[model samples]
Target: MNKFIKLAAAAAVAMSTGTAAWAADYNLTISSWTGPNHGINALMWPGLIEMIEEATDGKVTAEVKLGLAPPPAQMDLVMDGAADMTIIFHGYQPGRFVGTKLIELPGYEGNAEAASVAYWRVYEEHLAALDEHRGVKVMGLSTHGPGQIHSNKEVTSIADLDGLKTRLPGGVASDIGRELGMIGIQVPAPKVYETLASDAADAVAMPYEGRVGFKLTEVAENVYEMPGGFYRGSFAFLMSQETFDSLPEDLQKALDEKVFGEPASRMLGQAWDEIDRIGREATVEAESNTITIASEQDQMLYGQYADLITKQVLAELNAAGIDAEAAYEMVKAEMAAQ
Candidate 1:
């Protein structure tokens, strides 16, 4: 069977075995934006639900519901108690996330797993003071695998990006887009395939997983790969504060101690790594698709661009009162230790 079929089968098994024989005492709802076939829905959510159920010893369970709101609206949806839990992309809502941008910066040297575990650590140590995610309880934090250029147009050198219209998730990715002289097109992840299909944009900056998750192989037929990627996208898995407060103290303690932070983040990050690998394999299998690794000269030149973007972002975060330099170094150190 194909990987999609395998994902379906694994999800079926997880959902079947995750819950209690008796009904759960607290059954939560998960609002997801990715399509059912996407790894976030097919693997990550189910894995998380299983963790929740196990951590609470079957007292807590969650089910995912798609289209509860758009990607940018998830935090508000949970805060409003419309949904008990959801994942929000930090970049989707610009100025609101400054400290969160620490993980999204380019040149982090690790898979999503290390970055995610480090993300939770850095948030607790440095970023939580910002209260950027003030109203909701942050259950976990994660970053996707390295972001790359996906396009119908071939991009062999950094200069080739000039004047190209690319859908860039706003954050450091947009900073890079500006430096590279590409026209920035902003859109939610769900809209990428149609946007490219309609020829509204010629390229998108996303992790390898987009190859399968967004069906990029069919729309964006070429992948321009850079070492360690252009950037990593940050994500927060959130739960309603009201929902957490409503749970009994023991259940709350169980969730927090066993399931909520690093554990959950690691699980999601590992899932990202897996799906990213699958996406790469899918790209290799697609007869029409091609991946162009950046030449050494281009890599050296891109490093200069990355350095400029990094300094500018760090300065912005420091101005906002975050110890961003410390946080940035910590992210690298933590990833290295991992």
Candidate 2:
């Protein structure tokens, strides 16, 4: 049988034997969709695995396997036990997620670290009842750095963005696109480089890390940055319920109390903040790339746009029986305190 089956069989037999002091070792498989060089692969996964190993006293660890499935299919992959763990971008699945949008709303004043910690707290306090991640065990919740407009087309003002064909990851970003008069093109994150390079899209809404992660620095050379960004992307570090349940009680408790939840969320968020900084540096160092900070007038205009989207999204959540407005307030407060 395969290594997973062999290990699982051993675990099952040990558990059945009721060896109270047995220390079972587990190697979890983490499915990832991004390129091998992306920070999620090169940095986040390794760091998380280290946290897991440390917390479990080396009894549990994980390795990331890329391209097991596409971005949208990650959650289902974990549910089906094809992968033990993975990260899913909530927006990629569209209507499948509602409470998750709490973290994606724009105008939250903080970097990804603060946002992620706040996300975890807010999720526990208010969103846990949503049970949106039904089958999988949620290991952590995080948001990437604020997403800005990256384009080959010049964007010096909000008005300049009108009529631009832009790639938008659905969520508040799509609402923002509609308000800004952008013609939205939907594509997975990995396809961004080719889409822009081939002139299929004039611009993309992504965090700064896309500069290096998706080669946006080479294709979408101009960055029209708003102070708080157009939106943040929501991501969940998820594990199969089967995989989590299969672990020894001690190992599970260690992971739950020490490595998972807020701790993992903070780590992932901080990593995004660091990668965003690196992406900013890459942009400055690139020959043709330019960053145009939104003018005061443009920032004001975008704020109005953000307000409208925020109201509509919260109303949708409220209709679905979530106290989204209260959760929204908590998110903002938590982020600020962080």
Candidate 3:
């Protein structure tokens, strides 16, 4: 009986050691600025965490924490190691990201998923030279659905966009705002509802998802949608290089194969598209809100501006030695194939 007890104790010790080792091979923390119910927090992060845990065979996992920092500060937070991972809207940091504008330019005629997947392909093939994301590891690149105008007042024609105090998410949205003669107020997505409610901005340019995610329908009450939209917003899912490098080699390989790059981008983009549909439905169901499709003439006028924006972006990219025109063509072709 004593011999049997000794063997059992050894077995228990071995099992305990194995369990402790497996419990947290890597514990990553994700910082998010958006509200808890935001689709990114509610849907995308959960799915991504599941993918990571599954791919790493439960040896790696992530947790989401809110209010670690504001949206604009998230990149710095991750870079400084205050957080292991976070997402940033490229537009929020004006001069910091140029290659990302390639995906934000208007006239890309596809859902966010296709555009995002194409964006990743274009980045890997051509725009990687820009090295815009120099400090952190870029896990995924994505664009929000096409952007529209949400306002307290009705906006039926392109002319109506002029002189409105509009909240534009920097980057290409600023260019589009200038072309439309809008007075630009720069704010992050989470601040949008308060900005509108306080009358700090009379209109906001965002994807349909913002209608619900930011609670715009409660405050704005009107949506003016141009075909394709004014411009899409670019975003980056970033991980700290230090944190990533600290992981076991096998876990890194698992993430690269199962969770990063194109797969992650595709997942995020699909979530955006799905949330956009939900936001639209919610807006339509709200009796106070009205949706207006831009007239054909108005769309054509916007299209002309889009062409100019495209040229300007390409020129900027070329000056940066990016072979912008070819990159643009590649994005279009890849989007088409998708």
Candidate 4:
């Protein structure tokens, strides 16, 4: 009788442990529109996933699903619970995102890491009022490296861009294209290679990483770089509010404290900086592509036009009651400190 009782007790304990284990495990699905080999998918997502698993003590984890939706549809996918999380390019939605364009404006002098950290801080302190991400939990914010002109032909001066059909991502990039008198072709990053290959665009305004990430080195063999670049692009990592709310309180706290916000943003930005370095090195090693440093006079002219766009954006934001100037100053200061 005593042996039988002990056996029964052991069985009950094992069943309870199994039940607890099952309850603790949560799986999150991340939707990515970029190619799997892209830095975000290859480095950033894996790093973030590891952080999540570590922070949650193995109770929660994530997996990335490619082409779950197109880039512009990401935010809506997460909001609608079609995907648990996604990264959004602020410029992709145009008028739907105004304050985010502040980070996209030119003249910020910093690598992706510093800019990304500052972006998160600025959003928390100032841009949160815009509530542009109302339906989702903002996991983090980041900026890619500086945007430079990449083309198949040598571009020595601003005049070279005039009347050239260039691929512009959107938002301030489009605005800058207009200012420079370039005929703009709008396309997502993934399509850039084919667009250039098919002669749809003569040039593209993108970061150094594009040379390799989008296989631009094979098509666009010349890069025109300005001191601080013509502009930067803003990106956000977001989570579904409903999915987050479904997590256990402890898991939620763990994600908030360790895996989300500034930490994740910094990780992603650092990855971009590293990948950009690799891309630059690859382009140089190829010896097929040419790097053109914009002349001092050309840089000055680009800077002046960039300033006009900045002022126009700030004025619009201020008109919308966002204290745009103060926010812009804060971004500068935060980035400098970083």
lDDT of 3 at 315: 90
Q: Per-residue lDDT of 1-338 in model 4, one digit per residue for the tens?
A: 34224333433332232332354588778898877667777677777877887899878877778888889999999989899989999888888998888898899878999999999998998899999899999999999998999998789889999998999999888889999999999888999999999999899999988876788889999988887888999999999999999998999999999989999999989988976886787678777888888898988888889989999999888877799989999889988998
Cα lDDT, model 4, residue 328:
95
lDDT of each: 0.91, 0.88, 0.87, 0.85
Q: Rank the candidates by TM-score, best first.
A: 1, 3, 2, 4
Clash pairs, candidate 4, are: none
Q: Is candidate 3 or candidate 4 better by lDDT?
A: 3
User: What does the lDDT read for residue 179 in candidate 4?
Assistant: 94
Q: Candidate 1: TM-score?
A: 0.97
Tens digit of per-residue lDDT, candidate 2, span 1-338: 24224333433432231222234368778898987667787668777877988898878877667778999999999999999999999999889999888788989999999999999999999898989999999999999999999999899999988999999999888888989999999999999999999999999999999998788999999999999889999999999999999988999999999989999999999989977987898899888999999999889988888889999999988988989889999999999998
Candidate RMSDs in Å, in order, are 1.6, 7.5, 9.8, 10.4
Better of 1 and 4 by lDDT: 1
Off by over 4 Å in 1: 10-22
Q: For each candidate, give its TM-score against the true structure.
A: 0.97, 0.92, 0.93, 0.92
Please provide, for model 3 over 1-338, each residue's C-alpha lDDT reduced to its tens digit, 9 standing for 90 to 100: 34224333433332232342348677788898887667777667766776788888988777778889988899999999999999899988888888899999999989999999999999999888898888899999999899999999888889999999999999999998999899999988999999999999999999998887788989999999998989999999999999989998998999999999999999999989987987898789899999999999998988899999999999989988998999999999999999
Best-first order by lDDT: 1, 2, 3, 4
Cα lDDT tens digits, model 1, 207-301, are 99999989999999999999999999999999999999999999999989999999999999999999999999999999999999999999999
